[model samples]
Every structure is written in C-alpha cells, then in structure tokens.
Target: MQDITVISMIFTTILALACLFLILSPLFKWDTYIQVSSKGKDINATKEALLTTLNEIEFEFKMDKISHADYKHLKKQYETEVASIMKEEEELMITNIDRELKDEVEKEIEAQMKTYKNKKGEGK
Candidate 1:
C-alpha cells in the first residue's frame, strides 16, 4: 500500500540521518564532556573523589558501621592523599605560570630584536 511505502521511506530517512549524525558527532566534537589528560584536571578529579570518599567514610563511622581503629586509619590515609594532591596542584599552577612568563619574555625579546633590525636597515 502507498501508506506502507511512505512509512518505510520516512523510517529509512530517519535512520540514515541518525547514522550520519553519529558519524559526524565525533568529528564535530559534539560530546559535552570530553576527557582531557591535563594535569590540573586530573588533580581536581582525584581530589574530589578522595574528598567524597572521606565524607562517606566519616558517615559510616558515625553510624557505627566502622570500627574506631579502621575509621582512623582510613581518615588519615585519605587526608594525606588530599594534602599531597593539593600540593601537587599548587606546584603545577606555579610551573604553568613560570612557563607562561618565560614564553612572554622570549616573545618580547624577539619582537624587540625584529624592530631594532628593521630600524637599523632603514637608516642604511
């Protein structure tokens, strides 16, 4: 029947479009949460996960689900991990700033040399 044919055509068109979209989505970077391997991002994610786990561990201890000895061990371990992560994050930021400053200074020096050369050539 004509109705059946029309329905099939419509469905085929939709399927084709869906396939095309899936194929192009990655090329266009339509994914909302692209995982980047930057040190800062990893540090923040690790810190957040550790903090969440610490909160859960504390709650469990309060609810009498964990022994005092075990709770203390876990809390101390996680606190130490968080502290290290924070220190690393700070160091990464300082390193990044220093690198950017170096780059900027190099660029300025290059620009000044170019300008000086141009002026010297024009005076000849």
Candidate 2:
C-alpha cells in the first residue's frame, strides 16, 4: 500500500512539473531557424525543400523510379526556384543596406546644412 502511495506521489509530481514546463514554455525562447518575415522565411524554406527534393529525385532515378530525362527536367525546375529565391534575398538585403546608408547620409547632410546656415547668420 505504501509502495502504491509513493508511486502515486511520484506520478503526481511529474505531472505537475510537466504542466509547469508547458505553462512556461513560451517565456523561454530558444534560437529558432524560422525567419521572422513570412515572405522571406517561406522563400527560404521552399529553397531548402527543393534542394532536398532534388537530391531525393536523383536517388529515385538511380533506383529506376524516375528516368534520366524526367530527372533532368525536375532538377532544372528546382534549381531555378532556388536560384530565384536566393536572388530575391540578395536584392532585399542590398536594398535594405542602401536605404540605411541613404538615410544616414541624408541626416548628415541636413545637419551640415543647418550648421552652415547658423554660421552664416552669425557672421552677418
């Protein structure tokens, strides 16, 4: 009877701990591979998925499930998709950097113009 009681207590403790972890799970964040932007993340995920699928198709061709001609076609399509996604990501990064630099330059130019105007007014 004591053994049963001990087992029940242990089970209850484990259940409580599990509930606690579940409740706190959202509070503890871990590094995630998922991108924050849906468009970017979906594009990246599609690229990765295509790469894996291309590899699998190659394997299937070797196993006689897919013919060489069909494999070539499928591989080309996947490669094109991955390439397009990579290009988009690259362009997005370049545009973002350019925008940041442009903003910084504009701010500096404004500050310099203000200083020049102030100096001219003081000299007059």
Candidate 3:
C-alpha cells in the first residue's frame, strides 16, 4: 500500500509539471506571434466596420432617407474615413519595416565601428 501511494504521488507530480509547462509554453514562445495575429485581426475588423458603415450610408441615400445634400456630405465623410483608415494601416506597415531596417543598419554600423576601433588599438 505504501509503495502504491509513493508511485501515485510521483505520477501526480510529473503530471502536474507537464500540465504547467504546457500552459506556460505558449505564453513565452508565441507571445509576439499572437500579438501580430491580434493586430491583423483588429485591422481586418476595422476595415469590415468601415465597409459596413459605407454600405448603410449608400442604402439610406438610395432609399431617399436623407436629403440629396445631406447624402452627399455623409458620403464624403464616409469616404474620407475609409481613406484615412487605409492610410493609417499602410503607414503602420511601413513604419514597422522602417524600424526593423534601421535597427539592422545601426547594428551593422556599430559592429564596423568596433572593428575599426579594435584595429586602431592594435596598431598602437
């Protein structure tokens, strides 16, 4: 009975550790991937929301629910909103790429500077 209890305890401890590791692994390993995926999802949702709003505005205009002048103004507003959102998304992508490229170039420059300094010191 004592041997059985010991074996069961050992198995329980191992199982608990395995479960903990499984739960924590994604938090550490895939955090950045998850964040990027979430950002993409948000952008998609914003696009969909803007499109839906534009459709509604168009439907109201066609049904004569709004005056021609009002429809024209509202349509222009929606178009502007869509354009701004698209521009923001494009800017975000460009900024992310620009930042990464800048970081890489800075790292390369630092490495070259270090090498130059090392050679100068060696000559002295």
The candidate, 1 or 2, that scores higher on lDDT is 1
The clash numbers for all candidates, in the given order, read: 0, 0, 0
In model 3, the clashing pairs are none
lDDT of 1 by residue, 19-70 (tens): 9999888787533355554656777988999999999999999999999999
Task: Please give each candidate's TM-score.
Answer: 0.59, 0.59, 0.48
Candidate 2: what lDDT?
A: 0.88
As for TM-score, the candidate ahead, 2 or 3, is 2
- State the TM-score for model 1: 0.59
**How large an RMSD does model 2 have?**
7.3
Query: Cα lDDT of all candidates, in order?
Result: 0.92, 0.88, 0.88
Ordered from best to worst lDDT, the candidate numbers read 1, 2, 3
The most accurate candidate by lDDT is 1
RMSD of each: 6.0, 7.3, 8.1
lDDT agreement of model 1 with the native: 0.92
